[model samples]
Target: MSNEFNDEFVKEIPDHVRQRLDQTYEKIRFQSKKKKKHNIWMRMTAAACCLLIVGIASTSEPVKAAISGIFKFNDSGIEQAVNAGFAEETDQSATNENVRITLDSYFSDYNKIGFSFQLLFEDPTLLSGKVEWISLDVRLKNGDGEYIVEFIPDTKPLYGKSDYSVGVHVMNPIIEQKTGIAQFDTVFDSTEGNFPALSNAVIEVESINVQYANGEFKKIDGEWNLPLNKAAKPFEVVEYVARESDKIKIVKANGNPTSLSLTISIDGEPTETPFAIMKVVDEQGIEYEAGSTNMTVKKGYTLISTTFPISSFVHAEKLQLIVGNEEVELTKTND
Candidate 1:
């Protein structure tokens, strides 16, 4: 039985079937080897694709190393974006290590109300610097699609401690109402001051130019006129008198008996002093001897006289007398 089993196993297979089996085995082996090679190639391709993606991302929008940044307004978010475009353009234009630019109100809106900007930049080098000059162009448009006014800075080159002329341009050639020019100084880091020193730097508004759509620009020429002095009239002393005599004598008789001879001095306002009658009062309640005849002041008496305007005395409530450093109150009498 073992010999018979051996003989059956050793029997030759049909040619067609043998050939088909051989072909099927070879195809299976080729497919397995091809799959292994394909897997390796796929992994390499994936790794290459990842490296290319990383390289593109790194070079696309490279980060900038800015040395100094200048912000003009309190809210400069929008202005910063607009300036970014300028900066990009400038970056392509020049090759400098340091750059500075002054920004003015004309860059933003037509209202002539915008913050000024000053920028300082440093390149990644020891040499080669750049400076960019920028300013706003303000123009007002009317309903007729015509510019009512075109405002621009003057042609004077901006320099340190130099005045720049600013004004408006008209469509017409006529020059009329042009504003004056104001000069101001620009502060830099080398000014030997603190951070706030730059802030205190003044921007003088020199001349203002106004233009009409009809092409007419007028140069309004005039110094800044100050308002007239309308200050309220200061307090004025209408009447002042110093009594030095110990024995009070009434030389003049008015309707009231309290009249006495007084030396008067006045200060302030321009007016004629009205005739005033004076009165004499003693420590004891005693009236001085005076007849119906109006007594004239005794001669050889030291009587100093001065006059003041009526407006000065209008607000005086009471008249006080200082005799020997003693203040004496006097009653007001109708004269």
Candidate 2:
């Protein structure tokens, strides 16, 4: 792993890490005027940060736990998703000059989608720490090369030790050697977006703008495409009581065996916001976290779909949902 830390220049952290943290922080800082309707997770975020800093001083274990807590998914989480039938994973590559970009694979559901890529440079030195994206864009195109749905990507660099692991985990970056390639990951919503629904479409890379460490700017552009399809299969949502008036139903389970989750739709009175699902524990005592979730305000109910990844495929059954302020156990039985 690359032990490199940006000790002098603070430019070490890629922008998305800071940007998203700020966005999530500001989001909960001023969520609602009424104390009753206050977001539980957002309210706890600050304390979590404090705990993280304190943990860093005490032990690395707590720091690691705190850092991993930033997102609902991790490497193991991705493995679980793959086991659960992670949609159509397509690979394609494009090259310009000495730089070659390969579209690796992707994960998706009806409401959300995520994909990763490996950028390979013939001359690795050309890639620098100072590089900045002028813009990173992705969109869906048709057979005749027509624009369909434009995905406003939320981007991140997975390979380097950056602020995401540091600020959140408060640890050094997990750097591997400078292999010939660098991994880049990004995700965007499907339903809430203004763009039309993505059905049988090709996911393509529009452009990537970069500013090098030495002040040189480069924009690697391409039309790298991957075939994407909706992969979540609807299941008979088990009606489980979360609160006095609220009920949660496991709606759909994506079929990817390596990576899978039981989708849930929670409905109740207007006062209901949504449950803050902390973890999903199995019969074997393995606890999994919520990976990706989507919610919409319909005429009658707030339809929410949450995907929880168990440790593995065999560990997916006989599960319990750890949700809300009071952790309610929602069960999934083979019967």
Q: Which structure among the candidates has the greatest TM-score?
A: 2
Model 1 ranges with Cα > 4 A deviation: 1-76, 79-197, 221-335
Clashes of 1: 27
TM of each candidate vs. truth? 0.15, 0.51
Candidate 2 accuracy as lDDT: 0.40
What TM-score should be assigned to candidate 1?
Answer: 0.15
Per-model CA lDDT versus the true structure = 0.22, 0.40
Question: In terms of TM-score, how similar is model 2 to the real structure?
Answer: 0.51
User: Count of backbone clashes for each model?
Assistant: 27, 27
Q: Report how far residue 118 has shifted in candidate 2, in Å.
A: 2.7
Among all windows of 10 consecutive residues in model 2, the one with the lowest summed lDDT is 160-169
Tens digits of per-residue lDDT for model 2, 1-335: 11122244223334544353343233212111232222223211221231111111122232123122211223354444555555344446667656555555555443334555555557645543533322234555544455543433234211211111011112122111243344454443222112233456576666654434355556566655555544333222222222222465545444233234444555543465556455666666766655434344555555544444333345344455666653445444443
